[model samples]
Target: IKRLLVEVQHVKNMKEKERKRKVEEKKDNRRWIETQREREKLEKIKGINTKKYRKTKKDIERKRKKHTKEEIEKTELERRWNKEKKSEIKKQSDRNK
Candidate 1:
């Protein structure tokens, strides 16, 4: 049971790391998208709507893809709950022993 809790902890760590990485990636993407949109707006005001501008707009849209905050929080909770459950099981098993 101790070993099981160890495994659960490892899984939780892996999931949290993934969540953090994804959050960082989403933030980077948002920044890039906002920057691109700002540059495009500036170019449009300057009367320079080129193909590159269109491409950048499309790229901005692609960057808009992201997981909801609720989803991220749910996954994080699951990670914690699973680890806690393992610990609980260990306690029960020890009590039985």
Candidate 2:
């Protein structure tokens, strides 16, 4: 009877150890899941920031192109005005002579 009681106690101890191991495993899994969720959230935020950066870069490029176009138009208009003034001055000098 004493030997039987010892065997029963050993079995109970083994079951307790197994239960503790399963509980620890569950905790580890929960921690891993939380970490994965955080990592995905950070990745999503990074993606959004990257998209915003690209949009800002494109806007700056568009503005630069528009400014250059306006500058070219302004210079062309000045050139035409100068040419008209020169022609008018020449015509007046010829009439005077």
Candidate 3:
């Protein structure tokens, strides 16, 4: 009878251990699911605002330089025009002699 009791107690202990293991596995799965949901939400929001995001300083400076190229070209053209006008006036004064 003592042997039978011991066998039964051993079986019960194994079952309790299996139950605890299953519970831990369920908790791990739930945590994994929660983390996946959070990441999905973050990705969705990031996607929505991707174009509106601020650039790093380096990126901002690079873009600034890119946009200024045309403006610099325009200013150079204006400077050349003013220089030509002044030369034309000097030539007119010389011809008046």
Candidate 4:
């Protein structure tokens, strides 16, 4: 009878050890998955931020080019008008003479 009791106790101890090992393995797997998710989220945010910065920079460059073009055209028109006015004055003076 004592021999039978000893055998039963040994079997119970083995079962308890196996259960503890399985619980530890499950906890490790869950922690790894959580860390992986956080890393992916940070990378996505970084990519979006970079794209917005590039688009804003391009828009500023386009605006500067348009302003420069308008200024150049206005100066050209003023120079042409001045030349025409000078020629007209000379012609009038010659006719009066």
Best candidate, TM-score:
2
Off by over 4 Å in 1: 49-97
Candidate 1 matches the true fold with a TM-score of 0.47
TM-score of every candidate relative to the true structure: 0.47, 0.48, 0.47, 0.44
lDDT of 3 by residue, 4-55 (tens): 9999999999999999999999999999999988876786666544433334
Provide the lDDT at 59 for model 1. 75
Full-model lDDT, candidate 2: 0.91
* Collision pairs in model 1: none
lDDT at position 79, candidate 3: 100
Stretches off by above 4 angstroms in model 3 are: 48-97
List the global CA lDDT of all models: 0.88, 0.91, 0.85, 0.86
lDDT digits (tens) for residues 1-97 of candidate 4:
9999999999999999999999999999999999977766775657445565567768888999999999999999999999999999999999999
For 1-97, candidate 1 gives per-residue lDDT tens digits of 9999999999999999999999999999999999999987889778586987778767766666444566788899999999999999999999999
Residue 28 CA error for candidate 4 (Å)?
0.8
Candidate 2 residue lDDT tens string, 1-97? 9999999999999999999999999999999999988876786667556565678768889999999999999999999999999999999999999
Show where candidate 2 strays beyond 4 Å.
48-97
lDDT of 4: 0.86
Model number with the top lDDT: 2
- The C-alpha RMSD of each candidate to the native structure, in angstroms, is 33.1, 12.7, 10.4, 13.8
Write down the TM-score for model 3. 0.47
The window of 10 residues in a row where model 3 has the poorest summed lDDT is 48-57
